[model samples]
Target chain A: MPNLYDLAYDLEKGLRESAEFQGLKQAYDAVMADEAAKQMFDNFRQTQIVLQQKQMQGEEITEEEIEQARKTVELVQQHPQISKLMEQEQHLNTVINDVSRIITKPLEELYSENS
Target chain B: MPNLYDLAYDLEKGLRESAEFQGLKQAYDAVMADEAAKQMFDNFRQTQIVLQQKQMQGEEITEEEIEQARKTVELVQQHPQISKLMEQEQHLNTVINDVSRIITKPLEELYSENS
Candidate 1:
């Protein structure tokens, strides 16, 4: 008999085995193999995260930070590998989001006070 | 220079640190500390999973299986420890569902074809 944690472990395994996850891994590896693209992606992602954190914290994002982010995005977009990785990421996000929707269904009933 | 996989790893870490996950852990620990409760929980959860899987697979569930599941649910509900664990679980689930809603926001745009 599997415990709840065991069921969670299985879900993790299922996620790893899913096509979208595997595709994301493969695309990520492709980008990593290119030193220039990897460096560019790193810079772009760092700026993105910083800006996101700022927004989340309800802090005003300075124009300089926004411009810096825009430039970084431009650089990342110019890189073919990085662009491909982003596409793969978007595809993977769709799968992940769908999975989240399904996994949280039981909670919805409770949250909605319908059960 | 964090790659996409690093971001994914960070998300996993965040989930582990979230209140919902922590609450679930505490509830699970409490249940596990009671040998009898743990054993009963294991049996009850297994039966519930079986019935759920059968329903998902669109298979015909026998009256005996339904009766068995009802009995298991009744027993689990009558157990004080199980009831407490369920309450904790519901609380944790609310947090989890909210987290899912937030995490999937970016995907929602793509899914909705609004961007």
Candidate 2:
């Protein structure tokens, strides 16, 4: 009875107001408010982005770089606020993933038998 | 008032029944019905996947490989059914991208004012 885009926006509004999103936002805000945790998270993200860029460019990433990235991840995961933020991010991702799976169903069904 | 996942399923059904998706399905089926066009399309897809895998693995793709892939693409583009399928795929992608943009709004807004 209603437009698809209208329903999409309605779903968007619902997701933004949902509990998972609220917890993610709260955790993110807490991380941002703490100077040390924020800096640690920033460094971790920088490490991740650099590695991702190398991967995207098809450049060989050395073991040393991988080790450094792992250490950076460990450091950030050790922080209470950052750890909470990461946990909350996973929760939000579950909801987002569910929506994506539903959206991609048609494409999957189309290729199911042949592909 | 309804569940977010409920609204998502509603949007999914709407998208599946939309003109863009219907057109895409029709174009795809037409390609599958023609043996010559289907074989050409399959060859093009296999070429694309091989190159994509090379890129993912950080391997050097030779210029000859690139040229071969370019020729495969040209051959597919020349086919009526495959070309129509690509055009319809683009139309469906527009609809899918719109939904994705709506769904990602919260994450965007969260990081908007910060960084």
Candidate 3:
């Protein structure tokens, strides 16, 4: 019997392929209206490609393998704007750290002198 | 001047932190009801963590860097189910290839014999 992933994979592949083929005739409409929806669909398609490639290459599939694959894909799909946000957050965090360091410098010197 | 990623990062971080803090007070409700939406949010958060960590570690940020980061995050978020689908598609493709190989074997043999 096939597992949940196998079943889900087949279903999603069929939907995507059908959508693509329909696109050739201009019969396909947007199934997902938002960026997040689009991102999720794309991510799912990519994961399918990766799995298919691995199988074609004769990579062994194990039952014990964790399905973090879904979570990983999901995480990125759910947060379409994450990368940009991350870059900004990083810059802000750096500035915050620098300011903290600067503010603490005088206190550090005063403590040392008193000691 | 800050770039797109930097601005996007700050906005997302603010939103997430506000959401989290509101969560502590039970004032936060579901901003995204679907799995895909949740996945996109998670992916964005993870990317933010990675970028923030890199910056904290003093990794250099370059202006020339392509924002495939967003695309990657978006791809995974949008297609939250892609991984499982890929696994199934891979299995199906493998079976299809094997069947094709078997079917072609007799034709190849017949051709060889005729030659």
Error of 3 at B56 (Å): 21
Off by over 4 Å in 1: B1-115
lDDT of 3 by residue, B14-65 (tens): 3223422223222102313345644554565567677766666557655433
Candidate 2, which segments miss by more than 4 Å at Cα?
A: none
The true-versus-predicted C-alpha distance at residue B24 of model 3, in Å, is 37
lDDT of 3 by residue, A1-115 (tens): 2232332333333322342222321211232334564455456546767776666655764543327466755575456454333344345346434433432333254224312
True contacts kept of each: 0.00, 0.58, 0.00
The CA lDDT of each predicted structure is 0.67, 0.86, 0.41
Cα deviation of A76, candidate 3, in Å: 2.7
Candidate 2 local lDDT, B40-101, one digit each (tens): 98899899999998878878899999999999989888888899999998887887898899
DockQ of 1: 0.03
- Model 2 Cα shift for residue B18 (angstroms): 0.8
Winning candidate number (TM-score): 2
Q: What is the per-residue lDDT of model 1 for residues B1-115, given as tens digits with 9 covering 90 to 100?
A: 2233433444455555555556666667777778899889889978988988877655789999999999998998999878877877887766555545544444454324311
Q: Weakest 10 consecutive residues, lDDT, candidate 3 chain A?
A: A20-29
Arranged by lDDT with the best first, the candidates are 2, 1, 3
Could you list the iRMS of every candidate? Answer: 14.8, 2.1, 22.3
After superposition, the stretches of candidate 3 with alpha carbons farther than 4 Å from their true spots are A1-74, A77-80, B1-115
